[model samples]
Each structure stands twice: as C-alpha cells, then as structure tokens.
Target chain A: MLFALRVAFRYLTANRVQSGLLIGGVALSVIVFVFMTALIRGLALFLTVQTTGQIAHVEMEPPRRIAEVMGPDARFAAQPISTFQRQQIRNWQLMVDQAEQLDHVVAVVPEVNGNGFLVRGTAVAPIALQGIDPSQIDAIIPLSKSIIDGSADLSTGGLLIGAELAEDLGLRAGVPVILRSDRGIERLIPVTGIFRIGLSNVDRRVAYLSIAVARPLLALPNGVTSVSIKLDDPALAPLIAEQLKRQLPLKVTAWQEKNRNLETALESQGRTGNFIQAFALIAIMISIASALLLTSVRRRGEIGIMRSFGISRGFVASVFVFQGVIIGLAGSLIGSALGYRLCLFLSEGITGPDGGPLLPIAPAEGGYVLVIVLTVVGSAISAILPAQAAARLDPVEAIQQ
Target chain B: MTLLKAEGITKSFRTGDIDTLVLKGVNLVLEPGEMVALSGPSGSGKSTLLNILGLLMQPSDGALSFMDKPMSGLTDKQLSAIRNTHYGFVFQFHHLLPDFTAMENVAFPAAAPAGGISAEIRDRAKMLLGRVDLTDRIDFAAMRLSGGQKQRVAIARALMNKPELVLADEPTGSLDRENSARVMALLREINHEDRTSFLISTHDPEIAKCCDRQINVVDGRIA
Candidate 1:
C-alpha cells in the first residue's frame, strides 16, 4: 500500500498541470454545492424568523361546543350551538403554568381577543382588540421595538392602536376615543401608543389594551379568550402542540398549520437545492473519472512494464484509486473553506435596505463535513472504472503498443 | 532439478475470425545457472517463447514447469507471484518508470510485493545499482539518464528481487554498440557472480556467440 501510494503521488506530481486542473474542477463543483445549500437553508430560516417573530408559535383555545343528541336510538347529527356567552378558557392560569414549564416554551401569555370599533369624532374604523397583561406586552410580537410613536405603555386604562387604525380614526397620543365592543359595551379610552409591525393585517386592524380594563368591556371577567405560546424554536411548534393536545383538553394549533404557503415554499426551495447539489456531485464524479482514464491511457507503457516484471493488477488499480482519493480530499477541503469565506463575506459585508444581511446566506450551514465526505467517496468510486481498465491491461498488448 | 522445462508447447492468437499459430510443439530444458540465448529470424516465435517461459503469456497447449512444479492450473495471481519471486525480465526497450529515480525503479519489484521499501530493500537496490555501475546516477530520474544508463538501470531493476532466472528479450536492442556491449557485459557479470540463469532472445549472432549455448528457431519450432 505504501509503495502504491508513493507511485500514485509521483504520477500526479509528474503532471502537475493536469492534476491542478482536475483538482480545481472538483473544487469548483464543491463550491457550488456548498453555496446552494447555504443559500437555500439561510433563506428558509430568514423567512421563518420574519414570519414567526410577529406571531405566537402555538395557540391554545377553548374547544368548540357542538350540541349532539343524547338518546341512544336518536340520530347522531352535529348541531351548532348559538350561545349568548362567548367561549372562554376558565382555567387559563393552570394551562399557562403548564405551558411555561414545558421544554422550549419561552413565554405563555393569556389574552382576551375580540373585535370592536374605534371612533374619534365620527371617524370610525374596525379593530381586532388584543388584551394582555401589561408586563407581557412584547412577549410574542416585540411591540416595543415596533412602536413608531409614543410608548408601548398600556397601563392606567390606556389603549395601544396600530398606525393605520390611529390614522383612520384621526387619533393620537393622549386623545380619547370611544371603543365599542362586539358585545355592544363601550368605553372611552386614551390612545397611549401607535406601532407599525410591517404586517398589513396587524398594522391596520389590531389594537392592544391591558387585560384588567378589557375583562369588563368584553364581559369575560374571570376567564381569558385564549392562551398564546411562544417557543424558542418555531419548527418544534407542531410537536409541542401535539404534546399539549395529548396532555390538555383544549384546542392546540401550531403556526405551521396557519401558514401552509410558507411551508410549501420552503419545501420547494429545499428540493431545488437538492437537485443543484446532486448535479454538482455528478459533475465532480464525471470530471474525475475522465481525467483518471486519460492518465491510465497515457501511462499504459509504464503499467505494462510494471506488469511484465510481476507487479500485481491489484497494485495498479490501487494506485489509481489513491490518486482519486488525494484529489478529492484536497479539492473538497479547499472548496469548503473557500465557500464558507464567500458566504461570510456576502452575509456580513453587504446589507439590505432594512440593514439586514443582503443574501440571507448562513456560512455556518454550508454542510462542510457532508460535502467533504461525499466528494471523496464519490471520487474514489468514480476511479473504479479507470482502475479496472488499467488493471486488466495485457502486458503483451500494452508493451507492443 | 531443471530451472525451467517446456514440453510440446503451443501458442495461438485469434485475429477476428481466424487463429494463427505462433509457437509449435517444442521441448526444452534450462538448468539452474546456465546462460542460454534464443536466436531467431524476425518472423520466428523467439519473443513468444520468451514471454511464455517468463509467465507473461500462457501456452495454448502442453505443459510447462519450474523446478518440477507444473504451471497448468495455477491462477494468474499465483503465476504472478511465481514470476516475481523466481524470474526477472529485461525488455527490448528500457521501460523505466520515467517519473521515478533510478533507485526507486530498482526497488519497485521488491517494494511493491512487500508493501514498501524497507531498509533491507533499499540497501539491496543500492547494491544492485552500484553493481550496474550507476552508483552516481541512482538519484537521477529515469528519463534524465542516457540510453546506456537507462538500460543499466533496467538491468538493476530486473535483479532487484534476486530472482533465480533473468529473461532478457533483446535487452540491448535499442542501444548503440557500446551501450549494448556494456549492458550485455553487466548481464554476464551478474550471471557469473550470482549464478543467475539467463534466457536472452536476440537476432544478433555476436550476442548469441557470447552465451553458453544458443537455441535457434526457424518457424514456430526450435531448429
């Protein structure tokens, strides 16, 4: 083995130009593979963070109540219940405590959400009212960071409205507006803040208020309408929701269920990246195979001489294989390091309009180890045909040639 | 025991649809330390016979043996081992591995089989190179040597394994008179010093006259 390795290295170094070109070709393929992988994964992560950062990872709510026939012989028809009282979670504090104790659950916020109209001197606009504890104002959405005017202070019976809603109602900070609840109850609340969160729905139709003031207006004094959960990793939302459903009797929903389009886009992007990466690997294999085959042909006379003097066919084949391994190993290492540096440069050296990374490429996610292993193994495999060809060469025919 | 024995040896080649017989039935014997020459015309099967005796080609029919052991049913791998351990070959062209140094080429036959060039293998290679009068050129690349030096290196490489039989198929064919005589003298000296058997095939009568005895082939059979 040492003898064969030495011969292989000598052959490669003897034709330095050819070996350099072959390794460079393999390296370029590896770079493409790494870059595509990093870009696709980074884009997926960026989109996910952008979407999930403004919404709760999971939402736990009261189960829907449908009236069913009680008699044994009666037909089992599901009927909708039209009740005067709104459905609410009466023991929300218990669920909140349970959620907060679970792994990956960062925050468990109990809130009363309802629809209402904000009127300022007859300029009325509809709003989705979210009532939460003042201390948990930025638990899910980071409202404090998004606040464009005034402060995200919902204490002292003040209301926080979105920029669009405030504009529509012609209201500002310290201005009194009459908010009429969907249940016909109304209150004159002072607008304390206005925020713009980039989401059209949230910025135009959502309003925030303290839970202490919202309980009476919405007529849910002792219960919360829903419990919203924030998890450290949004990808685990569905798993956590499943666990929660198994443990609790409430309706648990993950954000993925609510945003199917984003999931589809990410899956499609991943598949495209796989195709690109596969092509890169195939390109690497083809290049290595052809170059090694050429080398074998060029060294036919020398191989014949070796064989004539009793060198085994196995030795000849192993020499070619070692050449492939060396080229693959060198190429992958160089390409991986170069790809990582390129990604880092693109991510850190360039900025987007919003001062974020321009390309959303994650240098850390380039799959370095995986690419290196694949390229080296693929290169070795690719050399097998040429190795066999060289090994099978008849000494008489080769010498005659 | 005879170093090599051939009985009714026959060889044929298939050219598309027809077979051409290259070697006909012939009987021959080689002793342990005899230097025999195979002399023949261009169309004669002298090279084919040499190739068959060296285990580089298989006889189409009949039996061959080395030291009374039959070569009939052995695998290619077994045949290769026998050739490596018991026989060496010097070709018409000095087919030295061009990228390797003279020392490396000399060490190859033994090194490849033993997995590497140990200190003993290296010393033996150096001794062989020195015996071939290429002591100063041992570190030079094979391609950098002159015709005579490369042939000498080839001779040293053939003796690297200390084989009992060294087959030379026109070993000095491509060299000038001076280099050819030098290479042949080196071969004769090694044959005398180590008592290594020689089966050299050549078309030159002068080269044949230098051997202990000469076998002449006219057609496919020995004349």
Candidate 2:
C-alpha cells in the first residue's frame, strides 16, 4: 500500500498544474457544500429561536370533563352537561413539579389563563389575560425585556397589558382599567407596565397579571388554569410533551403542534439543502473521476510497464484510488477551512437594518467532519471505474501501442 | 532440472470474424544459466512467444513449466507472483518510469511487492545500479538521463529481484550502436557473474550472434 501511495503521489506531483486544477475544482465544490449546510441549519435555528422565544415549548391544561349519565331504571338515561363550569387544573403545582423534574425542562410557570375585556372610558377591547408569578415574568414569553412603560411589577393588583391593548383602551402606566372576566367577575386593576413583543397576538390582545390577583378575579381561588414549560432546546418540545402526558393526566401540547406552518417550512428547507449538498458531492465525484481517468489514459504505457514487471492489478488500481483520496483529502481540508472563514466573515460584515447578521450564517455548524468524510469516500468510489480501467489494461497491447 | 520448458505452445488473435494464428505449435526448453536469442522477422511471432514464456500473455494451448511446476493450473495472481520473483524484463523503449529516479526505477519491482523501498531494497538497488556502471546517475531522474544511461537503468531494474531469467525484447533496439553495445555488455556481465539466464529477442543478426545460441522463428514455427 505504501509503494502504491508513493507511486500515486509521484504521478500527481509529476503534473503539478493538472493536479492543482483538479484539487481546486474539488475544493470549490466542498465550499458550496459547507456553505449551503451552514446556511440552511442556521436559518432553521434562527427561525426556531425567534418563534419559540415568545411561546412556551410545552403547555399543559386541564382535560375536558363530561358528566356521565347514571340511571336507576333500565330505560332512563338523559344527562345535561353544564356549560358554565370553569375548566381549571386543580393540582397545577404538582403537575408543574413533575414537568420540572423531566429532562431538558428549564422553567415551568403555572398560569391563570382567562379571557376578559379591557375597558377605559367606553373604549372596550377583548384581551387574553395570562396570570403568572411576577418574579418569573420572563420565564415563558420574556415580558420583562419587552416592557415599554412602567415596570413588570404585578404585585398590589397591577396588570401588564400589551401596547396595542393599552392604545385601544386609552390605558397607560399607573392607570386604572376595568377588567371583566368571562366568569362574570369584575375588577378595576391598575396598569403596571406596557410591553410590545412585535407579535400582533401578544402586542394587541394579551395582558399579564400576578397569579395571586388573577385567581380571585378569574374565580380560581386555589388552582391555576394551565402550566407553561420552557426547555433548554425548543426542538425537544415534542418528546418532553409526550413524557409529560404519560406522567400526568393533563392535556399536553408541544409548541410544534401549534405552529405546523413553521415545522413544514423547516422540513422543506432541509430537503432543499439535502438536494444541493447531493449535487455538490456529485459534481466533486464526477470531476475527480474524469480527471483521474484522463490521467490513467495518459500514463497507459507506464502502467503497462508496471504490469509487465508483474505488479499486481490491485497495486495498479490502488495507485489511482490513493490519488483520489489524496486529492479529496486536500481539497476538503482547504475548503472546510475556507468555508468556515467565509461564514464568519459574512456573519461579521453583513448586517440587516436591525443590526443583526442578514443571513444568520452559523459558522460553527458547517458540518466540517461530515463533508470531509463524504468527499473523501465519494472521491474514492468515483475513482473505482478509472482504477479498474487502468488495472485491466493489457500490458502486451499497451506496451506495443 | 530444466529452468523453463514449453511444449506445443500456440497463440492466435481474432479480428472481427477471422482468427489469425500468431504462433504455431512449438516446443522449447531453457536450462539454467544459459543465454539464448530469439531471432525472427516482422510478424514472425518472436515477441508473442517471449510474452507467453514471460507469463505476460497466456498461450491458446500449451504446457509450460518453470522449475518443473506446471504453469497452466496457476491463477493470474500466482503467475504474476512467479514472474515478479523468478523472471525479469527489459523492453525496447527502456520504459522507465520517467517521474522516478534511477535508483527508484531499479528498486520498483522488488519494492512494490514488499510495500515500500526499505533500506535493504535501497542498498540492493544501489548495488545493481553500480553493477550497470550507473552509480553516479542513481539519483538522477529517468527522463534526465541520456538514452544509454536510461537503458543501463533499465538493465539494473531487471536485475533488481535477482531473477533466474531476464527477457530482453529488443532491449537496445532504440539505442545508438555504441549505447546498444554497452547495454549488451552489461547484460552479458550480469549473466556471467550471477549465473542468470538471458532470452534476447531481436531482429539484428549481429545482436543475435552475441548470445550463446540463436533460435530463429519463421511463419510462427521454430526453424
């Protein structure tokens, strides 16, 4: 093998220009592979972070309760289900503890969720009220960072409303507004803060309050309505949601289930990335194979002489194979380094109007080891045809020619 | 025991729908430590017979043996191994690997099989190069050498494995008269010193006379 490698190296070095050009071609293809991989992965990551940042990775709510019909007689079986009864998680703290014990669970915040109307001076607007611990105001939706008025202090019966809701109801910091819950309960709460999260649903229709103030107002004096879970990796939401469902009797929902369009877009992007990567590999392989085949043909007489001296066909074939390996190894190494540098350069220099990287190219996610291995293995496989051609050359016929 | 033997060897090539017999049924024997020449005109089958005897080509029908071991039953790999270990070849064009140095070319047959050019292989190549009077040119690239020097390197390469028989197919045919004489002298000196056999295939009568004896081929038959 060493002898074949030596021969292969010598053959490549003998024609420096040709070998250089071939290696450069392969390197260019590898650059394409690495760039596309990093870009797609980076885009997916950015989208996931942007979406999951404003929502709970997993949510648990009380299951529906249907009253069963009980009959003392054989033919009497009519039951009426009440519609005014509130559905609330009675033991939400226990469910929160169980969810917190699960792997990847970073934060679990129990909430008193309800629908109400924010009214101020005859300007009434519907709002989704989310009641949580004021200390963990940023546990799920990062409401603290998005606060544009007053403070996130929801203690002393204060409410945190969205900017659009405040605008609609003519409310602002340290102002009192009337909140009427669906349970027919009413309270005059002072607005503690106004937050704008850039999402229409959150900025226009949602309000935050302290869980203590919300329990009495929503008619849930001791139990919360739901539990919102945050995780270290949002992608693990579905798996954690399944485990949570099995561990508790609550209805568990992963964020992905609620945002099917995002998942679909990400999947389609990944498939497109795979196609581009495949084409890059194919181009590299075809270039190497065709170039090495030409080399085989050019050195026919030398190969014939080697065979005449009783060199094994395997040895001859391995020379070409080793050449492919050398070229692939060199090109991929150069390309990976360049690709990473290019990503870093682009990320640092290219910015959008918001001062963030325009493309969100993650240099660290370029799949360096994977691309190198694939290029090298693919190059070796591509060389097989030319290697076989060189190995099968008739020494007598070749020498005579 | 005979070093090599061939009985009723025949070879034919087919073009389109026609088959042309290149070698008729022929018999020959080569003893150890003997130099012989195969002299024939163009299309006289000398090169074909040499290729068959050297194990580079298989005869259509033949019974061949080396050191009394039957050759017909062996696989291609086995035949290649036998050739690498027991036979050597010097071609008309020198056929040196142009990218390699003289020493590398000399050590190729042995080094390639052993996986690398070891210290021992290197020393043997140097010694062979010295024997061919190319010691000063051992490190020179094959292409950089003169025709005579290249042919000398070729002769040294053939002796790299210390084979019992060296097949020279018009080995000095492409060289000038002076270089040809020098190459022939080197071959003769090696044969005499190592007790190695030589089978020189040539069209030059003068070159044939330099060998111990000559076997002429006419119309694919030994004459």
Candidate 3:
C-alpha cells in the first residue's frame, strides 16, 4: 500500500497541471455547497433569534386557532380571555410556585392580552395591549432594553406603546390617554414608555400596561390569561414540559414546539444543507472518475507490467482508489477552508429584504470537516469502475502496442 | 530437467467471419540455463508463442507446466503470480514508462509485488542499471534514452526479480546494429552469469545466431 501511494504521489507530482485542475474542480464544488447552505441557515437563525428574544418562551392561552388570535385581517384581535375560563385556569401565583419546584425552572410570569382603542382627545387608534407584572415582565421577556421611551415599569398606572404606534397616536411621555376595552368601558392611563422593535407588526400597533389596570378595564376579576416560564437552559424545556404535564392539569408546551413554524423553517434549512452537500460530493465524484480514467489509460502498460509481476487485480485497483482518495481529500480540505472564509465574508454583507442585517453564518467546524472527509471517501468509491478497468488489462495485449 | 514446457499448444483469433490460427500443434521445452532463439517471418506466431510461454496468454488447446506444476484452469491472478515470480519479458519495444526514470522503470516489477517501490528496491534497480552499463543514464527518463539504452533498461527490468525464465520478443528489433549488438551482449552476459533460461524471438538472423540453440517457425508451426 505504501509503495502504491509513493507511485501515485510521484505520478501526480509529475503531472502537476492535471492534478491542480482536478483539485480545483473539487474545491469549487465544495465552496458552492457550503456557501449556499450557510446563507439559508443564517437567515433562519436571525429571524428565530429575533422572534424568540422578544416573545415569551411559552405562551399559555385558551385553545384557539391561530387565525382567530391573529384576527380577520391578520391583525391583533380585540377579545381577551373570557372571565370564566380565566378563573378556572390555574392562577399566576400558583403556577409560578409549582414551576419553581421543577428542576430547571428559573422564573415565571402571568400575562393578560387584549386590544384597546387609545384616544387622546379625538385622535383615536387601536393598539394591541399586553398586561404584565412590573417585576416579572423582564424575566419572561427582555423588555427593559426594548423600551423606546419612558419605562417598562407597570406600577405607575402608565402605558408603553410601540414607537410607530406612539408616533401615530401623537402621544409622548407624561401624556394621558383613554383606553376603551372591547366591552366599551374606558380608563385613563398615562403613557410612560414606548418601544420600537423594527418589526412592522410589533411597532405599528402594540402597547403594554400593568396587570392591575388591565384586569379591571377588561372586566376580569383578578384573572390572567397565560403563565409564561423561564428556564435555566432552554434546551431542557421539553423534559421540563413533560414533567409539567404530569404535574399540572392544563396543557403544556415547550418554546420550540410552540413555534412550530420557525422550527419547520429551521428543519428545511437543514435539509437544504444536506442537499447542497450531496451535490458537492457528486461533483467531486465526477472529477475523481475522470481523473482515474485518464490515469488508468495513461498507465495501461505499467498496469500490465504490474499484473505480469504477480500483483493481484485487487491490488492494482486499490492503487487507483488510493490515488482518488488522496486527490479528493486534498481538494476538499483546500475548498472547505476557502468556503469557510467565503461564508464569513458573505455573512457580513447579506441582509434581509427588509434591510435588516443577516446573522453571521458559522456552522460547527468539526461538522464541516466530517462532510469533506465523507466526500473524499465517496469519491474514492466512485473511482472503482476505472480502477477495475485498469487492473484487468491483459499483459500481452496491453504491452503489444 | 525442463524448467518450462508446453505441449500440443494451439491458439486462434477471430476477426469478422474469419478465424485465424496463429499457432497449431506447437510443442517445446526449455531447460534451466538454456538460451533458445526463435526465428520466423512476420505473422509466424513467434511472439504469440512467447506470450503463451511467458504466461501473458493462454493456449487455446494445450497443457503447459512450469517447474513441474501443471498450468490448466489456473485463475488469472494465479497466472500473474507465476509470471511475476518465475518469468520476465523483454519486448520488441522498450515499453518503459515514460514518466519514470530508467532505474524506476527497471524497479517496476520488483515494486509490483511489494505494492510500492521501496528504497531497497530502488537500490536494486540502480544496481541492475549499473550491471547493464547504464549507471550514468539511470536517472534519465526512459523516454530520454536512446533506443538501445531503453532496450538495455528493459532487459534490466526483465531480470529485476531474478526469474528462472526470461522471454525476449525481438529485443533488439528497434535498434541500430551497434546498439543492437550492445543489447544482445547485455542479455548474453545476464544469461551466462545468472544461469537464467531465455527464449528469444527475432527476425534478425544475426541476433538469432548468437543464441545457444535456434528454432525456425514457418506459418505458425515449427519447421
């Protein structure tokens, strides 16, 4: 095997131009595969991280279709959780206490969600209202840094509106606004804070209020719609959810499962990665096949002589296979390194259609290396036909010409 | 005792509707340390007979034995092993790999069984090249050598494994008289020194006269 490798190396070195071209072909394919896969994955990752960072990990609500919650025009719905169902569901305090006892649970917050018409002296506009605990809101959702104006504090009978919503309403800090719930009852609240998340859906029509004020305005008797929990490690949420299901009577879901659409998008990105990688491998195989075929034809007489020297057909075949593997590996390594750098350069420049910067694309380095190794092996296997052809040549006929 | 023997050997090739018989009812035996020359006209099956005896081709209807072992129904791999270990061949053309140096070309057969060329095999190839008086040209590419020098390298390659039987098919056919004589002298010296048996096929009577024994082939049959 060592002797065969030496010969193969010498052959390749002697034909540097051919070897370079073959390796370059393999490298180009690898680069294309890695770059395409990383781009799609990076986009998905950015969107997911933005969405999850803003929303609570787990959202508990009455079993309602997404269409209903999002409203007829796919806008925020005006209705709050019914008073009776809210009473029957476990209280925010009780659920929090129960969740804290679980191994990985860190914190929990109960929230009430509804839509209200904000009127500042005949300047009326609808806004999606979230009622949250002043102390626990930050734990469930990262709201402090998300504040566009005023504060995220819910104790001051104040309200926080999205930046766009606030702009449209012509309201600012220390301004009083009348909020009329779906029941037509109204209460005067001060605009203490505002936020702009740069997402059209959130910034155009969203507001936040304290649970104390929102409960009375929505005609609910100290009732909250959902209990959201935070965990020490988000990945362990599924196991914690199973435990929660066993302990709590209500339905439980992990954050990952709750956002099934995003998860599906992530999974599709993974499939795209696999497909691109397979395409690259196929390209490498083609190059290997061509290289081996050419090598075999050029070395026909040598192959005949080797066979005449008692070298088995299998050994002769192995020599070519080894050559293929060496070429594939060399190409893949160089290509992958080039691809990684290319991905890094592309990540900085890529942006969403909405003008948001795309996330930096960085896949596990070890995983990339594994993929290239597999490609080299696959290429060697693909060279089998050519190798066998070279090996089975008749010594007399081969040397005749 | 016969070192190599073939009995009732027959070989045929089919081209379109015609089947041409290249060898018919040919019987021959080669003793250890003997040098036999086969002289024949073109298409007389001298090379075909050499190929069969060298184990590069199988006789259509015959039995062959090497070192008293029968050679019927043997696998291609088995034939190749016997060829590698027991027989060496020098063709009419040098057939040295162009990419390899003369020494490397000579080392090829010895390198084959080992699956690669080692430093020791390289040294042996160099030594063999030196024996053929090509020490200065050993490092030169086979393609760069003169026709006679290339043939001498081919002869050295043929003797790399110290095989008992060496088949030479018009080994000097491509050379000028001076180079041809030089190549023939090298083959003679190797044959005499190593006691290696040789069966040479050639059209040149001058080359044939140099061998210890001579056989004439006419129309694929010993005449």
Candidate 4:
C-alpha cells in the first residue's frame, strides 16, 4: 500500500496544477454543501422564533377538570380547562421557580389569562387579558423592544393594549377604558402603551397589565393561571417539556407542539436540503472520477510495464484507489476549514440591527463532521470504476498502445 | 534443466470478421544459462514469440510452461506470481516510469509485489544500478536522464528480482549504435555472471553475432 501511495503521490505532484485543481474543486463542492445547510437551518430557527416568538415555547397550565376537586369518592376529574373561570394554577409561583431550574429553561414567568370585554363610549369588543410581572416578562419575551407606541410602562399603573385593539376602541395612550369580565364585573383603567407583534389575533383582542394589578381584579385569592417558559435553545423545548410534565402536576406544552405549521415547513425544507447535498456529493464524485479516468488512460503504457514486471492486477487497481483516497482526504479537510470560516463570514453580513442573525444560520460541530465524512467516502467511491479499468488492461495490448 | 519451454504456440489477432495469425506452431526452449538472440524482419512474429514466452500474452494454441509448470492449469494469480517471481522483461521503449528516480524505478519490480520498500530490496536495486554503469544517475528521475542512461536503468530494473530467464523484446531497437552495443554487452555480462538465461529479440545482426545461438523467425515460424 505504501509503495502504491508513493507512486500515486509522485504522479499527482508531477501534474501539480491538475492535482491542485482537483483538491480545490472538491473543496468548493464541500463548501457549497456545508454553507447551504448552515443557512437553511438558521432560517428554520429564525422562522421558529417568528412563529413561537410572541408566545412562550412551553406553557404550563393547570390540568382541565370538571370540578375543582374530586368528590368524597375521590375519583379523578375530567373537564375542559377554559381560558377563563376559576382555572388559575394553585401555587404557580413555586412551579415557576422550579421550572426555571430545569435544564435549558432560560426563563419562566407566572401568567394570568382571562376572557373579558373592553368598552369605550358606544364601542365595545371582546378581549383576552394577560397579566404578567414586568421584571419576569422581560426575560420571557422582548416586550420593551416590541413596543412601538407609548412606553412599555406597566411599571407604574395602567394597561398595555394591542395596536388594533387600541385603534378599534378609539383609544390611545393615557385614555381611560372600561373593562368587563365574563362574569359581568366591570372596571376602568387607562392605557399606558401599545404593542404590535405582527399577529392580527393578538393585535385585535389582547391586552396586557402588571400581574399585581390584574390578579386581584380577576377575583383570584392566590396563584396564577399558567407559567410561560423561554428556553436557551428553542429546539430543546420538547425535551425540557417532557421532564417538566413528569415533575409538575400540570400540562406542559412545547412551542413545537403548539405550532405544527412551522414544524412541517422546517421538515420539508430539511428534505430539500438533503436533496441538494446529495446532488453536491454526486457532482464531486463525477468530477473526481472524470479527472482520474484521464490520468489512467495517460498512464496506460506505464501500467502495462508494471504488470509485465509482475505487479498484480490488484496492485494496479489499488494505485488509482489510493489516489482517490488521497484526494478525498486532502480535499475534505481543506474544505471543512474553509467552509467553517465562510459560514461565519457570511452570517455576519446578513443580519438585522438587533444583533441577532436575520437568517439564523447555525454551523454546528456535528454538522461539519457529517459533511467531512460524506465527502471522504464519496471521493473514494468515485475511484472504483477508473481503478477497475486500469486493472483489467491487457499487458500486451497496453504495451502496444 | 529447461528453465522455460513452449510447444506448438500460436497467436492470432482479430478485427471484425478477419483473423490475422501472428504466430503459428512455434516452439521455444531456454536452458539454465545461455545467451540467445531472435532475428527476423518486421512482422515476422519475433516480438510475438517473446511476449508469449514472457507470459505477457497467452498463446492461441498449445501450452507454455515455466519451471515445468504448464500455463493452461494455472490461475491468473498463479500466472502473475510466476511472472513476478521467475520471469523478467526488457522492452524496446525502456518503459521506465518517468516520474520515478532511476533508483526508484530499479526497485519497482521488487517494491511492486510487496507494499513497502525494504532495506534489502533497496540495496539490491542499488547493486543492479551499479551493474548497469548507471550508479551516478541512480537518483535522477527517469525523464531527466539521457536516452542511454534511461535504458541502463531499465536493464537494472529487469534484473531487480534475479529472475531465472530474462526476456528482451528489441531492447536495443530504439538506441544508437554506441548505446545499443553498451546495452547488449550489459545483458551478456549479466547472463554470464548470474547464470540467468536470455531470450532477446532484435533486428541487429551485430547483436545476434554475440549470442551463443541465433534463431531466425520467418513468417511466424522459427527457421
């Protein structure tokens, strides 16, 4: 094998320019593949954020029950958990504290959600009210960054209504509005700010206030409805949710479970990515094979003499095989390094002012390793046909040629 | 003892519907130590007989044996093994690999069978280079050597494995008079010193004059 390798190395280096070109070609193909995957994954991740961004990645709510408690018989209760009514989770602050302690869970905030109506003058419409602590909400959502009108000023006292909801009621910052609950209880509060999250449902019917103000108004003695969670890695939401489900007496839902459209879109995009990668590998294989086939033909006379000198057909074939391996190994390694740097350079150029990458291009270590392995294997596979042709050459005919 | 033998050997090449016979009912034999020359006109099948005898081409009819082992019963691996271990070949073109140094080319036959270049094999290659009077050019790439120097390296390569009989097909055909005489003399000295038999095919009368016996090929049959 070493003898063959030595011969192969000399043959390759003798051509110097072609050998360099082959290595460069393989590297370019690998770069295209690796960079493509990074950009696609990053885009998928960004879309995940857009879909699950305004809402929580995982939401923990009290289990649905017909009755708040079991009868004297103490059988388990089954009931639809309404968004309204006495559905608050008991001891939710403790649950939030514990859930935030879970692996990969970045933030957890107790939330109060209820169905109500907003009324101003002759205009009245239904609304979903959200009550949350300002300090905790900041970690769970980019509330301050999302505000477009007025200030994220639930700090003092007042409400933050959605842009469309405020517009529908002829409301603006500092305007007093009447709020009516599902139970016919009414109260008046002034709007302190407005936010637009690019979603019509949230913009039209949602209103936000500090939990300190809305908790008592909802007639809750203690506890909040559910805990909203944000994870350091949104992809880990499902894993953390599974653990939280086992640890807590509540229903835990990951953003992936709540947003099936995004998951399906990413899945289809992933298939498309795999198709492109397969094509890239095939292209690399064909390029290497085509190049080495010419080399084999040019060396036909040399091969004949070697065979006549008593070198086996196996040895003849392995000479070319060894060439393929060298090309594959050298090309993939150089390409991986080049691709990693290219990804980093490209990601920086295509981002928004918010400092987060606009495309969400992730070039993970596992992804790089997979591409390198495939490139090496694919290159070696490309050598088989040419090597076999060289092996089957008749010594007499080849010498004559 | 007969080191190599052939009986009623025939070879024909076909293209489309026509079959052109290159050799017909040819017989050849090589003893333990002898210098023999095959002389013939162009297309008289002198090179064809050499190729058949050298195991590079299989004869169309009749059997060939090396060290008394018939070729018809041997597998491809066995044939390759016999070719590698017992037969050495020198070609009209020298056929030294252009990318390899003279020393590397000398060690090729021995290095080729085994994967590595062993110390003994390298030393033997150096000794062979010394025998060809190409010791000074041993480290030069075959492409960088003069025509005569390259042929000397080729001669060294053919003797690398110390085969019992060496087949030379017009080994001096491409060289000038001076270089041709030098190459022929080297072959003769090696044959006499190592007791290695030689079956050389050539058109030069001067080359045939130095051989122990001269065999003539007339129209594909020895005359």
Q: Of models 3 and 4, which has the larger TM-score?
A: 4
Q: Candidate 1: lDDT of A135?
A: 94
Q: Which candidate leads in DockQ?
A: 1
Indicate the DockQ of the complex predicted as candidate 1: 0.83
Ranking by TM-score: 1, 2, 4, 3
lDDT of each: 0.92, 0.91, 0.80, 0.85
Give the alpha carbon lDDT tens digit for every residue of A1-401 in model 1: 98899899989999999999999999999999999999999999999999999999999999987543354444554644344346899999899998888999999999999999988775788889899999999999999998888889888789988888778877788888999999889999988888999898998999999999899889888999999999999999999999999989999999999999999999999999999999999999999999999999999999999898889999999999999999999899999999999999999999999898899998999999999999999999999999999999999889888
Residue A160 shift from truth in candidate 2, angstroms: 2.7
Docking category of candidate 4: medium
Off by over 4 Å in 2: A68-84, A93-104, A120-123, A166-176, A188-190, A236-249
A1-401 per-residue lDDT for model 4 (tens digits): 88988888888999999999999998988888888888888788678777766778899999876553435443444643334236778888789789868888777888887878999888998998888887765666676787877888787768888899888888888888998876667889888888887789988988888888777667665888888898877888889999999999998998889889888989999999899888988988999999999999999999988998889888888889888888888888888888888888767766778886655777663167887888778877899899999998888888989
lDDT of 3 by residue, A294-361 (tens): 88998888777677656778778877888888888888888888888887765556776756545546
Chain A TM-score, each candidate: 0.92, 0.91, 0.84, 0.88
lDDT of 3 by residue, B52-167 (tens): 88888889898999998899889987887888778888888887778788988898788867767789999899899999889999889888998888888889998888899999
- Candidate 2 per-residue C-alpha lDDT over B84-157 given as tens digits, one digit per residue, 9 for 90 to 100: 99999999999999999999999999999999999999999999999888889989999999988988898889
Give me the displacement of residue A137 in model 1, in angstroms: 1.1
Residue B204 CA displacement from its true place in model 4, Å? 2.1
- Model 2 clash pairs are none
Candidates 2 and 3, the one with greater DockQ: 2
Per-residue lDDT tens digits of candidate 4, residues B187-223? 9899889999899898889999989999999999989
Q: Give me the runs in candidate 1 sitting further than 4 Å from their true place.
A: A68-85, A120-124, A166-175
Every model: Cα RMSD to truth: 2.5, 2.7, 5.5, 4.0
